[model samples]
Target chain A: MEISSKLLEKAVAEMSQLPGIGKRTALRLVLHLLRQPVSQTDSLAQALQELRTRIRHCRECHNISDSDLCEICNSSRRDRSLVCVVEDIRDVMAIENTGHFRGLYHVLGGKISPMEGVGPQDLTIASLVEKVRGGEVRELIFALSATMEGDTTNFYIYRQLEGLPVTLSTIARGVPVGDELEYADEVTLGRSILQRIPFEGSLNR
Target chain B: MEISSKLLEKAVAEMSQLPGIGKRTALRLVLHLLRQPVSQTDSLAQALQELRTRIRHCRECHNISDSDLCEICNSSRRDRSLVCVVEDIRDVMAIENTGHFRGLYHVLGGKISPMEGVGPQDLTIASLVEKVRGGEVRELIFALSATMEGDTTNFYIYRQLEGLPVTLSTIARGVPVGDELEYADEVTLGRSILQRIPFEGSLNR
Candidate 1:
């Protein structure tokens, strides 16, 4: 689109750099900012700047935090021996909100995706392996997605800790709870059948 | 979502204020920004700040610009006596891209929407009426949407220019080009048949 003002064009160009946002959406967003009070735009800019300039990642888990050590790492109630490995802080939040998991987290930042040029070294795999070798964590739970990259990352990490004292486990993969069996994909349905647990185990949860 | 970092939560809160962006999408966008280089976020914040602080509206047309007069209003090639009234700069850009209309534009900024508490006084209708009464404009073409608010805005402006020498006209209502007539809505198809133009007139374009 032919924007009249140079400032407007520059704003749109920068806004479109975000994921899933295009030039048209950027224009619409910029126009919306223009229509609102000046303080709204100022606050948004200020908030993003503050977050980037001051945001810190937990030294142990690699999740975003405001301090040197994340709250979960500093907490005493969470089980430090049971570490749940996830992609990033978003996943950390999701698992935390479920109120089911009582373990600490190890954020890999991202999975190993060859297509995106992200290798094992790009994530926090080295730190996780070091933690396991330190003989503190009893079980390392792989809570990543079901994608190929997720499985590859899990296998890569599992290989890094071969013969270690820690026991490695992965989250169950099968049909989701509350979903109709007919709507479930064939692969998931097949996996659910093959990985069927005892009838008492289903009732205990 | 339960964001761990106060800074992250603040950024998401500010980002979610934009239209159509909820907390989840805001978190996703904010996390994407976090994954990129800090310089990208800095540039986006700077561009938005500059756009909101330095953006100006044209004195004559009311379109967003960097100077007192917009490019279309300042251009000598545009027809001064023939004005096309629109809702905002987006409409102006859409019409300008067609390259068919040579007339100048008068941006109303918004339409009359009672549901939103927006009335005639909120727009640039007064200056538009003054321009028409100045005895320079010979024809006033309204290019607003076909919604009820658009019709009310047009009628509101038309009532203000009662007995004025300028001729008033609205853009034609008809089925869109390349659209199958069978799929056209009943109201639009009925209007298109009722306001059918002569066959020779259609051939001229």
Candidate 2:
């Protein structure tokens, strides 16, 4: 749409460059900023600039961090011998929120998606393999999403650490915790039944 | 959501401060920015700051502008004697896109909403009344949205200009051009029937 002010139009254009945000939404958001005090916009701009320019990725896990190492990697409490592989730090946050997993994380940056031109080489898979070769990690758990890309990345990584002493396993594929059995998707239900755990093991959890 | 980096968390918090964006969406958007080149985030921050700090409002109509006067108010082609009163510049953009109205606009910034603690004094109502008293505008068209707050703002303005020589009118309310009559809301359909125009006049348009 044609905007009256060139500066406003530029701001809207920049805002809409983000995924899922349209020109109309960008205009609304920009107008909202205009209505708010200038300090709000200033802080927002400052924060974004600081994040993009000053942010560092953990040298070990590749998760976004304030310093060379992320808190998880720096923490002595977390199990260094157990690694959970994920697509990005978002998955790290999700799994961390669960308060169940005590393992350290291996952020892959993203999955191998041929459609998007992302390859296994684009991720931190090489470092993960090296870590496994270093003999500290006893088990590597694949915690990526249940998408085709996630499966491909898992298989690719599994092949990379082929015949290594370290064990490789994937997170369970099943109907979610709160979902009804009948209402679950066919493949998910089928997988749930096929991967059913022992009765005693389920009760223990 | 628990973010790894302080800078990342700050960025997400700032992004979620925007209207309609939740914490999850904010994290996703912020991560998307991190994946892109630093230049993109830099430009976005620059554009927002420029818009917020340098943008001006038209002295006459209070519409956002690059200079003292907006394009519509500065142009000689638009009818200065005919003014369309709208809630904000978004409405101006919508009407301008239609290319039907040749009149100038008076942006009220926002409507009167008691629920939000917004009153007439919070908007540009005083300037609008003064504009009417200036004796330049011969007709005022109310182009505000069909909402209780819009009606209140319109009525409040109408009262302010009561007994003035200028004429006041509201845009037509009926079934939208492409909408089916059978599916229209009851009040809208009832109003459409009650305000039926001359069949030949409709054909001429």
Candidate 3:
């Protein structure tokens, strides 16, 4: 049934386009918004609009920020010698929430999933190699997933930096197969990061 | 615990401020947004911002609209002489969604409540009275509520239109107590509207 007016219908339709929100849920949300004070709804609208205009991906770390550089990358208090590489910005956030890591981050945008047509060349691996070659960093932490694609991506990066003097290690294999790093609890993720193993040699292996 | 980075924390804080969303729920929503593609997230942000700037409450009917008057009020097909007086704009939407109501609406903003310090003077009761007295209306359907405050507000409006030649009526009282008119299903709500009762003259009885 048409449970909403035309304008409300349009608003709900737009909302339904968002991930995970279906038409009924969208209708409920729109109805809830209609009950709210105009100013309250206005704030939500303002925040969403400003989110894109104000926030950008940090060019250095690829983290979300309101400027070219993210707060983590710009902060001097962080450990410049240590860099944790991740598959997405959400991973950066999950790691940051632990507060034990004091290093910078490098978001790869995604893993090398050959089935999805994602290859090493499509990722930020080249930039990572450049960052390591820049001379200040002493350690490179691979905090990617334990999935097949993640393993493949990890091996590819390991091969690229096999001869570098920098200490190269992965966050660890304790993270379950097919599980994302962002979904691992802080205790598990932290333990995995702390117990990282050195890369055993070549991507061909 | 600092469960998210400062930027993510800030975004979560803002999200939790929305009605019915708590910290955990807000975090989930933020994480979901973080997982989306930059373009999709950007669209959500843009939609939110435009929701406020592009939309405004109709000056006449108080329904949300992109222009001065709501589409319903602007439509030449709707009956201008029949005004459906409602407790809020959501009620207007509820009726409009049925595709049945062909009349304009008058949003009272809220029901009269003494304990909550809300009274007739605090609402749009004066404007409603003025609208009825303008002599262009034939019926004033009070789709208020079945609660004490709703009854009181309806009574107040009925008294205001004491001498007006318009047919004064209260939306059917079968609606459950302390429930919002917006939650009633279209069939029940539509039936309630069709079965509206005349507000018989009685001061205290």
Instruction: Report per-candidate TM-score of chain A alone.
Output: 0.93, 0.94, 0.81
Q: Rank the candidates by TM-score, best first.
A: 1, 2, 3
Candidate 1, superposed: residue stretches over 4 Å from native: A201-205, B201-205
Off by over 4 Å in 3: A1-60, A65-71, A74-76, A133-138, A165-168, A172-205, B1-17, B20-60, B65-69, B74-76, B163-166, B172-205
Compose the digit string of candidate 3's lDDT tens values, residues B117-191.
997888888877887788999988888876788888888888888988999776654556566999887767887
Q: Write the per-residue lDDT of candidate 1 for residues B26-92, one digit (tens) a residue.
A: 9999989997899999999999999999999999999999888988899999999999999999999
- The local distance difference test score of each candidate is 0.93, 0.93, 0.75
In model 3, how large is the Cα lDDT of residue B3?
41
lDDT (Cα, tens digit) per residue for candidate 3, span A1-205: 3532455556676767755568766666766765566666665655554553455788888777767888889999999999999998768867987777999999998999979999888888899899888888899899989778888988898899878889987764556667999999887788778887688686322
Candidate whose DockQ is highest: 1
Using lDDT as the measure, the top candidate is: 1
TM-score of each prediction: 0.96, 0.95, 0.65
- The deviation in Å at residue A197 for candidate 2 is 1.3
| Candidate 3 positional error at B197, Å | 13
Return the top candidate by TM-score: 1
Model 3, residue A15: distance off in Å is 5.9
Candidate 2 C-alpha error for residue A3, in Å? 1.0
